[model samples]
Target: MVSVRRVLSILFCLLMAGLVSSLAVGYFSADGIQWIDAVRIVLLAASTGWLAWGAAYAFNGLLSLPLKREDKTFELVPTSARTAVLVPVYNEDPVKTFSHVAAMIGSLHALGVAGRFDFAILSDTRDPEVAEKEERWFQRLQLECGAHTDIFYRRREQNTGKKAGNVADFIRTSGALYEYMIVLDADSLMEGATMAEMVRRMDDDPRLGLLQTLPKIVHARSFFGRAMQFSTGYYSPIYTRGLAALQGTAGPFWGHNAIVRTRAFAQSCGLPELSGRPPFGGHILSHDYVEAALLTRNGWTVRVDPDLTGSYEEGPDNVVDFAKRDRRWCQGNLQHGRVMVAPGLKPWSRFVFVQNIMAYVASPLWALFIIASIAAPTLKGVPDYFPEPGLSAVFPRVEQGLALTLLVGVFGLLIGPKLLIVARGAISGVNETFGGTGRALLNTLTEILSTSLLAPIMLMYQCRAVLEVFFGMDGGWPATDREAGSVSLSEAWSASWWISATGLVTLGLAFQFAPEYVGWLLLVAGPQVFAPILIHVSSRSALGTAEAGLFETADDRNPSPVVLRQEAILAHWRGAEASAPAFRPVPEPAFEAADAER
Candidate 1:
């Protein structure tokens, strides 16, 4: 006989599948409401659902505002508290990763926290070339910056569990020496003060298993990069804070830029390799959220301190790059379903999984909905009115203002976050906080325009990921080249044609059936169909040429990010005239651990 869990899982899967199939059949059957009208209803409902969710998310963010810390102060901790900083690296840029470590080490030593904190470079790089680079960089980091701290390097002989496995291995063997472990991504940077503060917070709040920070985007040079940076800075906080509010003890773990209690994590976060095949079965893709859920389920608080600063990460610089990164996320998030039905899972865990599923699935649903709305009028149907019984059994009716409803909901949800960010920035009088209202508004417009175009492309990409996850495709942690700044048109064309095809199909379908709406929607999707060309020209070099009046540029129109000016100036000054201020390098320190008395 099958287990109870398996039986329930089978029943739930069958139920969901049946519901979806019934909807699909009803929408497509010629004998039902005219095919066109049926399609329209499905599309309209799905699109509306997406926009509604987005609105809910916006409000959720707003509601969480009161709970967020407004005054930022670093909580100082005794460095001798047996703390270890864990930097997990997959195939990542060693130079860039080490540069961050060097910077942090200097900052910590400056604050007298170096002696208290030890550094661990836990690498899971599988590629031989990347692994070699990581090794060389670790040694260089030790020579250049690790002397003052106890620096340890360990590469998994087999990168069996990806990041979670790597962390698990460390916890099992070497974790007992440290009271807390600070986790950072390969591209992540956090100040020593923040690290010390996190340690302090963890110590003070014994029930707190994790303390996460809002990571600001840094080193954005490309047009897409700047756009993404703007969005991350402006909009991420609200959503994050909202989630934090709801999850006073169930906050998300974004895998990095956080500190975890060693004992709590070791006891709670041993992720079971999901049973079954590839993609969904073998290894968890987005392990951070799952780990956080596991910890939370065990009565540990997972807090997000959005007020904490000095955390940073980079964005994928272009459209293609963004989608490439998203493909993996799509797979990972979709795979959350495995745990969604697992026994002993928390309600918050289910909520996170559902939210993740919608992130990817909603795109395809919207695409379908958009197509259906346009085709509705063209369908040959029976009499407009048909009903039965006292309950008035009937299909969902098509609203005459369907298009307006769709646009309002989408714009409100997508545009509201930015507007709120702008309002917050203006109210606070922090011009640089969100790159100013002028830039924020412009960024919002650019985002709306760009996302609209790219939506179709992303829809196709997401659909592919969905199918792949269903069919078992692996999106293991790929070695990302942080400095791999540019992509050729050939690369763009080769990678992005599916999106182009999706756009083209949308255009074709819309034009054929919904000519009235097709013109407007096509106008939106045309650039997205050829996003590679548009995105490339929007970069810095293109901005320079356009600035030179090559394309009839009249006044000085600068799209360069104002927030980057300070950092850019520093870089320029360091490169041009003098050497950057050099700090005393950290000398290798020793550690002694006592065995527990028998």
Candidate 2:
């Protein structure tokens, strides 16, 4: 059934692509098809197909039933497997990251399962000053959680291989100490029960190499952050369900908030540096996807349980931060060219590799299409109406009709799935989680508008990143400013001046070569011309407020116990007044007695 669904999904996208390409054929060949016109048509169809592929996923997910989850009342059996909760950090603030650690530790103890799980703060932080701070915070973490041997901190003198290397180092030295490991990022926080449930699932299936949970974004305060939070909480589940349907035994490991079999990962995921230099070579920067592929290649069952909640992570608060993060991801995906067709990988795994690469490559293709359209008139000289002196003078026809049709089709493909989800939410009363159906619809519209405005700016950024990689500029691992504040106009302009210039140049070419396209070009290039203003405004945390009720995710109103626990711990440590205990036991009422041990 899964295979059938996957095949149908592929066919649907191809059909959409072929249909749009045929329309493009008519549109471009109206004056008779030229070589450049063919290029323009192909680009338009490919980019449109990418959008269609995304819509297909959403539609498939909307129809597919969610993965079966155990009943909430199901008793958790005690497992003898020793599991290490590994939190890998790199040049991050000890205060915030350790607070999450303290919260998870307290939650584990409150569940009375601390004995089954131990934690290691795998520090790949290179700065000496940061290392000293990490040690001091580790001491405080022990005291705060009242833990000694259960919580350990290891800092490597040389931060080799970045994060993947950090975990591989742990597997080499201490993989023998545990049966499983829950790898987490610096910002990841999971509830005690979720961790236990993961362990229970792993124990039940010896072949389960990795079990990934869908981690929600928490503690977002800015407008962009809140809007993104709403999208993830609302839309991600539906989309991930579709992914879960497609990814049967060969699944994704997002590198965090996942439980992995220690021996399986240690044996299968020992990544070697690729043969070439930076960018296309060296250690894999996007190690998570590669690790998943490797695990699947080794015959270990890898899967994601989208219904498994209570897992959380922080996101970039503003646009610049998001773009910066995207650059790293683009570089990593580009690196996948080396491993896309390795000897023993599954077909779906290779498709995932292609999917990720096209995500970035699509931007440049769109740009190329636009450029070609603008230059089409001049590139093809006056059509030879009477070739060889006897042909009929077939007059050229206006091309706007099919072009407009293709445009509407592309827009529909992009926004239609989201609207369907909105409609379903309203019908099902699920929009109440997004502050009721009215607000949900309004917010969804607002998100659509914002994304439309931001699309061109992101396109330029991604195009530049891809071009840099092509020309051998490696996107090194950069420290993320996760909680970025506002950006000044000057800063915005400084980062995006080339974008403004590119937009201006495109408009000028449209006017000179394709006068009829000036209006259309304005729509695409106008946003880029004003990108600095958009970036500056979106970065302002003040734009997004809880009182607005525009982006009210369920987490905003009813935060999970783990989220509240982390916030409470953070507040206490940061000297803010706190009104709650270190760990608040929810349904596990029996463990409330263990709260005071902190």
Candidate 3:
């Protein structure tokens, strides 16, 4: 028997799906649709239905917020169980990564519970220069805070399985010493109090295997990044809350900013390499979701707590960077097709895999729908609206009304949840978090316009990603270019030339065959034609102008203590070049002594 939460979630999705399919059928049938038109209708309905289902989750979240239950509070009880704060680093900037570590350590020390936790910098960086820099930064980190905290750094000679492999190595070696492990990305930062509370909650619940917090975006300065930050701050909570409501005990693990029971992870989360080459096989790229599913399969609960604040991370500064990350994620999610059928998985866990797969698959489906629409008119003559001789006679009529209804429904699905969130915020007096009502409205509009312009570009990128993955091309883990300053038009054009060509050819075809759709086609083609301008402008630091207060999030207006501390620490580290000595290896005796003490 399915649980009530699962039943309700399914019913809601089915209801939305039925309505969308009905609307699509009505619109497509009114003008006596051809075979290609039927295919377009089916694709549009499936894609739009998936989107509406998401909006429904956000809506459910808003309704459930008032009734959400609270967890047991952390009141500084004496904790016997130890936690290891695992910071995994790839070929990232060592200075910035160590700065985050220092800030988190300082925050934990301020909480007076720093003694119960140890910090581990697990380095999987293959670059020799980066590895040396990581060692030097580790020395500086220890020299600064080693007196009050336990910090350890280890670098692997070979990064066998990427991050998952690095974490598995830690588990095999030192996981026995810790009851719980808090995993963080190089860019991830969590407040000391929140970390303590998470530990306490885990200690209290033996069944809970993972506690994932909602990590808000911070330190975003570029227009694209700020817009992303604002959206994450304002909209993600509602969606997450809805997800939590539906997930019940089977929540998501985002790989970072989450706590996991060391025992549960070791028992059930040992990942196996799939039987194939890149893209669909080998080491799982998105191992977090699989781990969560495995934990649940082993009867451990995975929970996401949206109410837990102060967990934060940085985002890519521009569209190009975002696409690079998305390409990798696309391959990972698509790879879940293999894991979806793994033994002993819970039903919802399997559904979650399907949801993730659709997230990328829907993009290509939408693109195909549009392409078929553009090519349909050229393939067939105008359909006869009148009924056949044997059928009931109906007046010949175009389905403009039904088509308009479907269009409006799609628009509503895309924008209605946001408007609903705004309305709820106004009613609950939470609009101030968004910099007040007027500013919130303006920023919402700005976000909508900006995302609208970028949607087509992203759609093209995702479609390319899916096609490339299907063609067995793997997007290896590349160091993210987070600090790339303003992108020039030439650079943007070089990256998006194919987009321009596609747009030009699409617009030309629409003009030649389906002249009436030129207006609709512009929505897809115009952005691509001006991709360079949009990319360059959005990537500019000055684009985050304060005149209209666009993209002003709560974290931006009233920064949290942790955020402020992190900024200060980063500034100190970046400024003080003479305070720390160059890289020097710690003696083997010192390492042995630290391990013996543990």
Candidate 4:
């Protein structure tokens, strides 16, 4: 039985697509239905459909309140079931990574439940220098936390399956040692209270196999990074609330900041590498989503509790790094076409797979729409009005009003929800926490404007990535450069030179062949023309904090104890750099709600 919420969502998408696509038909085929017109309409429907899909989530988030926070009256005892806190690292910074792990240990110890949990540093660090550093940090982390018995460290010489494989190996060797496992990224940190609450939730539900947290982005230091951090703090909670509403029993597992029952995961999530070599085959890149589906497939409930706070992770500080991360995800998502059809999966699970694919597919779909729209004017040939003698020549009914309505409809879909969220915040005094209503509104506008500009540039990156995957170009798993500095002009141009060239050529062709859409073409292709500049400017850390704290969130204003503790550890380590050991790539690893945008 389809739930009412699901039905409403589906109907909304259908009606929105039908209304706009019909207007497109009326406007493009006023003279006669041509093949080009049909192509334009289809593309418009698909691309707009994806836009509306996001809008639907946004609207739901606006209408709904944040998920109610749970009361933690009950406490875990020393005799409670044991859980392992797993931090998987692959060729990542050792001091920074261990700092987070050490902080989590301290946090748990503060609650006096440290005995109930074990900490494991699962490393697949391939670089010997980095691995040696990782081992040194593990020793330091153990010494710092004084969890000689509970804290453990192990490194796999063969990181065959990446993060997923690393965790699987842990489970296989120590599956019987613990009842539950809290999987975390190298950058993940959570408060003691939050971990206790998550354990409580799992204890309350016998059928629950996985519990996901909405991790806030921290330590972002650039324009792009700060924007993401702000969105994660201000907008993500609402979006996550909406997701929680729709997720039901099958929710997201974002590869980290999640807890899973060890035995259940070991039984259900022995991921088989796809039969092919890379990209479409071999180890899955987006293993989290598939693991969630698999858990649900075997009757284990997978859920995300938005109200769970104190979870945190890091993000790419620059556009180029972000695009590089997306390339791998794009391949992983495209590979989901194979898993979406697996036996006995829930309908919603299948839909979720398709939805994830569209996260990247929408880029190329919109690109195709623009190209087809530009070509449509010329392909229509000549329209005939005076078929017989003395008949009045008609200027092909343009339906200018209908066209205007469609244009407004599309733009509304893009920005309308942001406006509503702002309006709602203004009414609810939520703006007070965000540095007053004025700044909230201004910041929202700035975010929308900036993301809109970046969208076109990112769309080109995704389009190329999609083409590469489809044509059998396997984007091998690459480590994330979590420590990238400001991107120089030369570097930005090197990365986006082809993007600029594509934009210029596109605009030139659109103006020359189809002058009618020159304005539209500029909006679509103009940003790409300035991709290098935008990328470089946004990559600088100084500019992000110079706007009088415009993008600052409450978290930035007063960080949680866990975040503050991590920073303290980091600072202390930096001071002891001369005394510390050094280290060194595992393929380190959203939106349109894409990976929760945070």
Candidate 5:
């Protein structure tokens, strides 16, 4: 009699034990492989590496389970200790940035705890025009929000650390003045009540050096826009919660949308520039994991409060915009390779580094795996050897089953968390965030389909970004200014040909030889392969006008310079037609008056 439950349990134990053994063997075995085997070896090693990450994600999800309670309430009151709100900006629209900052300052002032909080606008802008505009904007902002906030602005003469260096500079200079610093991106906004609550959580738990809040995705409007908005709303919280749970005292740190203890950050978070050039040189692209690891090494706890709400951020408008952002992130995550082996690092920190690296490396490895699988069927001489663990009758079955199980682990990590979060939301009746269960299900299905297409597209982009970074191309944190309206077919094809070509070749090979498996590979990666051609062209018309709704949020709320400039150009044309010049520009104030005002 096959006892179904007992058999399942035993199989599960064996599967897990095999996975551990494989990973342990792979990690140690990695050193023995030569150059030609690097790709093959890395793929095999990563199978084990990725499983460990999946386990961590699963463990993180478990730890964050308590935070899912519907009735829970956070302590919202302010403590006596001071807090610093660090707003980090690159070359972003300073006017919009100041507006959001002003709103939060007003909210804090209304709460009567404004004096206890301080705000610093940490600028890394180097462009002369942009820097000048930011300086003027800061002056106006200070006059407006200064009554309730101790507002200050700092720009580095040398933008050494990019975002990380900008932040480290802040800690070195003004860190001693505050107990806690809430890090905010230029695009980020946080509610005062929630800000106070984060501070309270830190005050209550002396061991806590970091507490990250879940940020609501905002300012999306296009079809592509909606996809992003829906995905972030549906997935980020649970994923973050899972991470928080697994990390406990050793959680990962995102550079923004979180709070850090000033003293802990000052002591532990000074990022040492990696000894290399370009993508791996002068600075680590992703600094959060390194900082978190440093913090953990010093006995400070890092955590993510998924239940913490009212924090908000914006997403990229469309596929092209997303790719632009990913380019920088790819370089940043790839930089973690050097940090993983650094001296005196904590156990969890190493895990964090591996997780960061996998985000980019996995896509390429999967691409290579697909190539290998296809070639495996046709090539008579190709290696298909399976290791025999000494049980004769079950050896082949065990080997094949183990291989299948190992591969399934990748999908489990990627897809399992989404399914679990969806289930949790359904059980807890928190499905309203996705506009109810019906919408959530529909969106999830749509996302799976679209993401399949995006996978190949992203694979190529990440590959390009990684290669670019590797070959000494600098993807600095440049703010995106997405053009509204449609992109041309030529443009899309040019941008996406490599991915599309790869996809076409894969499809051709799969159809020709491996009929059984090629369809599955194409189904998962087909859309992504042609993403540049299909998505970019399809999204172009939608981009330029009201259809390309990237800046609809800013447009709806504030007048756009684009609009204003267009109107000005037209007015000048109309005046010239009427044989009269357009209204004269406002005369500059005398030097004496400008000096007096200053």
Candidate 6:
């Protein structure tokens, strides 16, 4: 049976959905709607309703502030439990990956709790050269961190199930050595205090299977990167707190930057490879969500601590990189359709799967709505209400006020969460952490403008991703490009040519046939027209983002000790000369010899 809190949360979402859908239907049917308009209305309501549901979380989060429970301080809890800090790597730059490991080890040592944790470098690198680099870097990492720390390195010859498989292999082999495990991505970094605190929390709560930290984006230099960093730092907590309030014991696992109970994970998260081919039915790409569902199914509490500070991760530096990452996520999330109906899953887990699916599915729906609207002028003739049986009127009448209200409501739903989050922060004095009210307000506006312009671009990308996935295209796991860089105009055009073409065609058609709606269409079309410029400029560092006082977070302005340590370690690796020559492709015997030497 569902708890009262869960029931209330579900009802709240449903009520919001109903209200938004009713308003949308009323707006569309004001003129005794054509069939195309009717379909558009339904799609609009669904998309906007999702947005409204999220807004409800932010609002609820605001109200729950005073009632928020305080967490036990980490300093009070003795670090006695054994923890395995698992750093999973694919074919990634070894120097950068190991630097992150070194930073974490250093941070742990500084906390005087290094002995309580062990570090594992689990590699699934297919490239022989990269494998060799990994070996060299592992040696360097040990040398830098000294022999006192328990750091182990292993590489799998056959990359079976990718990351999930890699982790499962470790658990099956050596997971019993530790009481708990902290999973870190190649780019993930966390303060020693934060790591200790997570373990402490798990220790205090025996039923807690997973505890996820809210990782802020760091080292974001590009304009696009800065905007993401700023938004994540400022708004993610409000949204996350709201999710936690509703989720209670059933929270999300973002794969990395989270600690899991070894026994619980080994028991529940040994994912079975779905029966069939790629895309929908192969090895699960998005394994994190499924793992969380499995944990919940087994009655293990999965929680996210929004207030846990000092966890950090890097983001894709450009639009292309972001889309590439999203493509993989899209395939993974879409694949959840198969797991949604699995036996024993909690209702909230099922809803999470549905939400993940809609995150990608909504893009195509939005596209379809836009297309229907564009063609509505030509596709639908004059409405004749009297032609239908039981009709009381002849010509359909348009209600300008109703249409305006619908437009305003939709935009409000889309943009209100950010405003509410900002307001909540100010009210709770959380805005001061983000550099005070004046700075926070300015940053919010900047993020809003930037995100509004980027939204359509993302919509098109998501639509393409969804279509490609449905057509059985698999986005293979690829290492994300975290290096700061800018794309040339030609590169940008190559990536966004479809957007430009769509914008031009959309504007042309609107001007030719639906001149009255051209202003409205421009909101969707204008950004596409300048896609190349937006992509190019946003990827460039010279945008004076810092000078313009655009995207500054408290962490950015005043670096935490762990962040400072990470920066120092990164600099050390970058500045040091290559200790070993680049591994050249050689015969199998030579490779074996190299492996033996290592």
Taking the tens digit of each residue's C-alpha lDDT, what string does model 5 give over 243-279? 5545557776777889999898888888777676666
Q: Which segments of candidate 2 are over 4 A away from where they belong? A: 66-75, 383-395, 474-484, 542-544, 576-598
* Alpha-carbon TM-score of each model against the true structure: 0.79, 0.92, 0.92, 0.92, 0.76, 0.90
**TM-score result, candidate 5:** 0.76
Comparison by lDDT, 5 against 6, better one: 6
lDDT of candidate 2 over 1-598, digit per residue (tens): 8799889989988899898999889888877888998898789878888988899889987886533322342246878899999999999988799989877876777677878888999999888898898897677778666553388889998889999999999999999999999999999999887899999999999999999999999887677777788889888888888888888898898889999999999989999999989888898999999999999999999999877887899998777888888998999998888889888999989999999899999999999999899889998878767755676676778788887997788899988998888887776666877788888888889888888888899999899889988999755333433335667777777777778889999999888888878888887799999988888887777444667776778777666666777776776666621343343322333234334322
Please provide, for model 6 over 306-372, each residue's C-alpha lDDT reduced to its tens digit, 9 standing for 90 to 100: 8888799999878888998899999999999999999999988999999999889988887887777
Question: In model 1, which regions exceed 4 Å deviation?
Answer: 1-39, 63-71, 75-80, 374-402, 473-484, 538-598
Who is ahead in lDDT, 1 or 2? 2
> Deviation in angstroms for 582 in model 1?
17
TM-score of model 3 (CA atoms): 0.92
Sort all candidates by TM-score, best to worst: 4, 2, 3, 6, 1, 5
lDDT of 1 by residue, 463-577 (tens): 7777777777654332333334666665666666666776787788787776666655865568658866764544433344323322210011322121222233234333532
Lowest lDDT sum, 10 consecutive residues, model 2, at 66-75
Model 3 C-alpha lDDT per residue in residues 1-598, reported as the tens digit of each score: 2267557766766776677778777765555667987788778878877887788788777887564233334467778999999999999989899888877887777768888889999999988899988887788899877876899999998888899999999999999999999999999998888899899889889999999999999887788988899899988988898888888778999999999999999999999899988789899999999999999999999999888888999998888888988998999999999999998899889999999999999999988987887887777676554557777666645567776787787878888888888777777666777788788788888898899999999998899999999999755333433345567777787778888889899899899987767887898899988887898889988443843577888776666666766666666676665455543332334223322321
Model 1, residue 326: distance off in Å is 1.4
Worst 10 residues of 6 by lDDT: 583-592
**Candidate 3 Cα RMSD (Å):** 5.7
